[model samples]
Target: MRVAIVGAGLMGAQIGCEYALGGHEVRLHARDLRRAQQRVDEGFALVDRHALFTADEVRAAAARVSTAADPGDAASGADLLVESLPEDLELKTAVLRAALAEAPEAHVATNTSSLSIAAIGEAIGSPERTVGTHYLNPPLLMPPVEVIGGERTAPETVELARKTLIALGKLPVVVRRDVPGFVWNRLQFALVRECAWLVEHGVASAEDVDVVMREGLARRWRRVGPLRAVALGGIDTWNRSGRGIVPDLSNARELPDLATVAITEGNVSDDAGARDAALARELREERALGAAR
Candidate 1:
């Protein structure tokens, strides 16, 4: 298999390296060549230090991965095309349109976390070939890659993406629709919204909130989903109990003032840039460890 990945940043490089390790030829494209090379170098370093493969295997994978000299050249002869561009809808759409224009026969995928897959596919004018392939961060080790089908996405295209993820040893979930944030973020953000409200309303401090989620809710939800947790004649109880709280749940149309103040007070791990990186790394490490088990 030949794979072309746009955006050779952290996520892109990790995903490309995974394909290379899976015996697929991978070409990573970037607007900035120096940055792309730096990421590729980091990928090789990770391959060398990784516990999953031998020196010989890492060398083989390194040989299979390469950076494209020009961005346009990346999609020239690819079997699968991946867009891991910035979160901006316009930027992602433009890149996908140009890349898909050059590789009409290639299966197209966007690693978008929130943007609507159907909207992006409409912008690309190739919805049938395009599907959302949201690779969770630390793509090299993460197991789940949320897969969503656009309004016009063909069933075969979705299956091709599933097969592609499986080939790379990834767990892929077929999202029922091309909704924003797909399945994961929808559930995740719903929890986050309430967590914020709980903090603001003085119900719990941040750390205690963490304790409750970590020791109680997460411990249970980690194994059985919420619906499954209530499956054994508990649905009636849930329905009766849930209705009372449903109206009182957080319904903020914008970010809570407390959230803004937390960040303003240096709460992204303590500030925006470093905090985000640290949190992302921690989550990635946790997911990687869980996947290993």
Candidate 2:
């Protein structure tokens, strides 16, 4: 398949690399040549880190990647057109409008993290051809790609998107309805809000809270979601646990003043680099295992 990725940023570049690695022709379109080149460099660096291929192998894969200055150039003859532009509604609308005009036959997908797919599709003027193909940051490493369908999204578009993701070695979870932030962000935000509340109330220190989650909840969550984890603990036990847990302040006034200040000061304990590297390593290992098979 010929895949065209608009916006040569981190996510867009990574997606292009993934498609290239999967043996597809990929075209990366950016507003500027320098930005496109930067993304290509970053994509190669990530591919090298994973050891999915040697430098020579990456170079070969990169041969399949081309850069374009405009939407029309990238979308031309593209089988799939993916937009990974900024999260802004108006900007995305403009890009999609141009893309659809250029590649009327290509399936369109958005890498929107939280925005409404319905709204984006409306802006593109062909809602049936547009669907949400949200990838987690660093698409080369992430295994799951949420395939969301807007109100006007066609069934064929969803199936084709899923099939294309499968070809790229990703697990595509189809979301039938368009929801804000999709599934992952909502889940993450729910936990974050509570964690912030806890810190605000002096319930636990930030490090300690992270320790508890990483060492305790995260491991369990990897195997089972929260609801299933509770179910496995026995309904009676869950009931007892639920009864003891008190609800925090749902109002703005309940927010801890120092919590906001701490976050602004970049005191958040998210080990973003370590997490990204670890995930990349895992993906490389998986690719190695697949190659062995």
Best by lDDT: 2
Candidate 1's residue-wise lDDT over 33-148, tens digit each?
78887887776675565445578888898888778755568887898998888898898877766776678888888899999888888887888888999987667655799999
Residue 288 displacement (Å), model 1: 14
lDDT of 1: 0.80
Worst 10 residues of 1 by lDDT: 260-269
What tens digits encode model 2's per-residue C-alpha lDDT throughout 171-273? 9988877988899887776777677776767888877777788889998887898899878989899887777774443334343554462434443335566
TM-score of 1: 0.84
Model 1 vs truth, CA RMSD: 4.3
TM-score of each candidate?
0.84, 0.89
Clashes of each: 2, 0
Measured with C-alpha atoms, the lDDT of residue 69 in candidate 1 is 54
Residue pairs with backbone atoms closer than 3 Å in model 2 (clashes) = none
